[model samples]
Target: MSKVVFITGASSGIGKSIGLYLHGKNYKVYGTSRNPSKVNVPFSMVALDVTQKESIKRAIGEVIGIEGKIDVLINNAGKGITGPIEDTPTEEMKFNFDTNFFGVIDVIKEVLPSMRLEKSGLIINTTSIAGYMGLPFRGVYSASKGALELVTEALSMEVKSFGVRVVNVAPGDFATNIAAGRYHTPVFENSAYKEKYAENLALMDSHVSSGEDPMMMAKAIYEIIKSKSPKIHYKVGGFMEKFSIILKRVLPDKIYEKLLMNHYKL
Candidate 1:
């Protein structure tokens, strides 16, 4: 029997690419969008809003009803927030965490029961290289992905004995529709960070616009699903972005901080 795969945020970008790639490989894929009627994917589409528990429950139930079991669950529904730490409102930070962190948790909770009952499953989370080191203007976005990465690490150990595996796929900048979906906090005309915010926001967008194809990430995900024992974390992106992970681990705190600042032109 073909393994069943479920993915969130599949209306476009990385999530949509992965759903199509896996379905073409005969994985029996189901993808979700906040508005199912708007999704134009070939695979089955489910209406899911991960931040809401009831929506998550309904989506998971629908999948289970048709597939009997979910062999792989991809938590890819997330958006980015940009602003200086002090200028970012509390509500905005909460909104970032709602979709990036808590939403992932809610969906995982709903699917784990079924995965645990079957004694086998794979949970692949989409994290980012920014999660490793807090970015200057995008601190809130960084914090959310960083939190998810830690949860993925801890969850892997907690469910290892149940024949379940959890892993985080941290990609660097990718050419996707993330820019269109990104949320920017309100900035006052006289705010201290006004100038820097404008500069950094453009820089971030440019980097993402010139990033590698989203299909690269889809290929990496496909490989992970085929593996019998995948690593707890996989970094997928350009050479520098992948190497930065190593640099952060081996370099001293102060030195690494300097390098990070220099790289972002802070």
Candidate 2:
């Protein structure tokens, strides 16, 4: 039987790339979007809002009703935020977690029973390289993805006996519309972080604009799906981007902080 794959946030960007690529490979692919009718794609795009629990339930139920089981679940639906921790609204960070962290968990919970029943499943979480460190002006975004990474670790072991595998795929940066959709706290003229926040905001967007192709991530996902024993974490990105994770492990804490500060020109 062709494997059934369900992905969230498939309306655009990396999620869309994964869906289309998997569809071309003859896998049964179903993706999610808040407004399915707004976009057109070769694979199925169901109505889903990660922030809403009922929506997640309904979407997964729809897929399972037809396919009877999901072989792979890609948690790709997420939002981004950029600003100084102090300057950014607290509510904004909470909302970001609602989508990026909590929403992913809820979706996994909904799919786990079916996966466990079938005695096999793969869960690929879309995390970020930023999650490995607290970057300047992107602290909130970093925290959310970091939390998801930790949960993936915990869940992977917890579900091992059930034959359900959970892993994180952290991408450094990829050219996408995430920049335009990100919640950017304004650089208030009187705020202490005004100048630095504005400058870093632009830097964040530029990285996305010049980042690697989304198909790279899509290809990585496909490989993971086919693996017999996939690793706990898989990172996809440029040389420096993936190397940064290694540097974090070997470098002194203070030196690593300095390197990031210099890179961001802080």
Candidate 3:
């Protein structure tokens, strides 16, 4: 029998690509989105809002009703928040974490019972490269992803005995709508760091617009799923991102910051 997969945030970008890629591979994929009507894929699409417990639970129930078992759960739906921490409001931070961090938690919680009962499953949480290396103007988004990294690590250990595996996929600047469509926070009328905010926005826009293709990430996900034993973390992107990870490990803190500031002209 073909493996069954559940993927969230399938309306567009990486989530959508994963759904299409897996479906082509003959997997029974149930794609979830806030608006299932907007998803163009032919796979079974379900409406889900990861931030809401009831929505996630209902979506999982719908999938289970048909598939009977979930072989893989891909937590790929997430948004981006860009701005200085000092300039960002407390409420905005809460909202960002609510979607990016707690939202994933809710999805995992709802699906755990099924996986536990079956005693076999794979959970792939879409973390960001920001989770590994902190970037300017993305403090809150980084915080959320960093939280996910920790959670995935703990989850890997906790679920190991159950024959369930948890892994984190951290992709660097990819050609996706995340930096554009996924970035939004209530702006204040007047702020001291308005100029800095503008600069950072322009910087982020440039990087993502000119980044690696999202399909590359889809291929990475496929490889991990095909692997017999996947690692706790998988980094996908261009050669520069791989080198950046190494540089961040070996270079001095000041040097790394200097390199980033210079590269982005910040």
Best by lDDT: 2
Better of 1 and 3 by lDDT: 1
Candidate 2 residue pairs in clash (backbone atoms < 3 Å): none
lDDT value, candidate 2, whole model:
0.95
Name the better of 1 and 3 by TM-score: 1
| Residue ranges of candidate 2 with Cα displaced over 4 Å | none
**Which lDDT tens digits does candidate 2 get at residues 1-266?**
89999999999999999999999999999999999999799999899999898998899999999999999999999999999888889999999999999999999999999999999999999999999989999999999999999999999999999999999999999999999999999999999988878888888999999999999999999999999999999899999998999999999999999999999888
Q: Would you list the C-alpha lDDT of every candidate in the order shown?
A: 0.93, 0.95, 0.88
How far residue 6's Cα lies from its native spot in candidate 1, in Å, is: 0.3
Question: What shift in Å separates residue 45 of candidate 3 from its native position after superposition?
Answer: 0.5
TM-score list, all predictions: 0.98, 0.99, 0.95
Question: Candidate 2 versus the native: TM-score?
Answer: 0.99
